[model samples]
Target: MDARLMDATFSRNQPSDARRLYDDRAIRYDNSWHPRFARHMVELARIHSGERVLDLACGTGLVTYPAANAVGPTGSVVAVDISTGMLAQAKAKQADHKHENVQLLQHSVTDLQSLLQLQGETFDVITCVSALVLLERPYEAVKQWATFLTRGGRMIVDVTHPESQISLITFERVGRKLGRPVPFYRVPFQSPDDARRLLEDGAGLRNVVVHSVSQMDIEGRDDLQAYLSDIQHPRIEQAFTIGDADRLFDKHITDWAAQSLANDDIKQKARAVFREEWVKLADASGQIREVDEVFVAIGWKQ
Candidate 1:
């Protein structure tokens, strides 16, 4: 861990805004991404019939509903999250699916102990999707979940690749071209190794398994360039602000559609600069039209 890394507690203590941010975006969350991360969650959990499942930070029920289907009518699912609006969406999704065995709990991952204790039950499998970046204490949060896990139970968490989640200011631009554009990434850790160590070893899981897969390819679309531009706009700030975020986001798309320029030329020059240094990044990212996804990380708690 870097000595300069921000304290893990910062995310947990001041999560209200962040919670609402996801809540507000819940409706469009699934549509924005190119890949189906829920499939990765199922693969990591290896969900079985008749087993209880807990989806921590179950935003808008993406993984929750699939888990319910995996377990079927005999099994039950407890979906937990910090956002009430998000929970409401999840509840609505469950109703839409007519899943009688699924339960939605409004709670943060940090409060898993109390939530589980109140239910008087432990889950056979726990899974999370994309909410890892919003957590304040990733290590403590995982440890708490592990403590509550059944003897053979395991947890599967999906988060944005840390390497992809770098500061917006760090990218290098080519002359008259948008330098190599970087993917938008969330905080907590910058590398999978760091995530594994913090969530598994530091958290005291017996045997931790880590797998990484890509989620989206930003190349080939001028719209994507606009998408990235809108995210950083002063009035928009994709993941941060509330009002007009979508409007600003739309501006990126709308403007890109109107502009007649080549992004491939800029990208190619940037690729030349970092090709050897960022071979893995090059392989992971491709055109959204040609590629299905960017990357997904699956961690198992032993």
Candidate 2:
């Protein structure tokens, strides 16, 4: 990787789970339900012809390509993400599709002013999807990015409700028991009102509209292997119950335990509590589901 990408990766000060997802899981991202949400975020942005767009944490150009199409040759879309691997995928897709209007930047979303001020540029719209909660200072990040929006320009972002990803929730619960708290991201965007507060209070945005998609998206059960595959690959929504516990533990949780720097006691206790929690999450038919309610909020600069 180049120095810029290296800085983008190592300098952001994000949570370790962000690093795990961007570095190791970027290639497998589109396999999850993220693309669906990304499309929804852009569709709601309502970009116009000849408008400039900034897409933050744009993994593999999910939002970029569609926004590029909306902007056409007369406009440009700058898609930024911290992961070189994710940008590489996006670059390949840009090449194959011949999208000349899109620029993929391997940069941290946390620092955009210096990144764009060099060009004296501002955007008509800014988008970030499925990424805000990963930041160490998510609201501050929003306020910083909002400064790059032109007068009356819109900022669009999405955050899942606290109940969305049960796997991470359960993992963090186990972490608390072991005295090492996994980075908990469930405190914000629990409702449409929460999303609006982040925009209005943090960014001083106006006319904020919070759209609650996936409100009705209840958890559904799958086999153990399939559920593991979803979380192992970083599902858009996570942690369902059911299936073979041994395979789930060996394949996914074992690595998690190691990464958590588990002593034998921690490992054994973690496994026990994880299994207990996992079993508790399952239904009578041995299936688990996630209530992945997501809020896509759009607000305009005053």
Q: How does each model score on TM-score?
A: 0.62, 0.74
lDDT of 2 by residue, 1-302 (tens): 32123323333346434554576667887887667656666778998789999999888999999899888889989888888778878888987765588888877787776684325778999999878877768789999888889999999987765556555666656665666534445554456788899999998899998765652222573222222222112234444546544455555543422235144535677777767767877778887666646667899997
Q: Which stretches of model 1 miss by more than 4 angstroms?
A: 1-12, 116-119, 165-188, 217-302
> By summed lDDT, which 10 consecutive residues of candidate 2 come out lowest?
223-232
Question: Model 1 over residues 64-106: C-alpha lDDT tens digits?
Answer: 8878888988998988888877777777777678558888878
Largest TM-score belongs to which candidate? 2
C-alpha local distance difference test of each model: 0.53, 0.70
lDDT of 2: 0.70
| Whole-model alpha-carbon lDDT for candidate 1 | 0.53
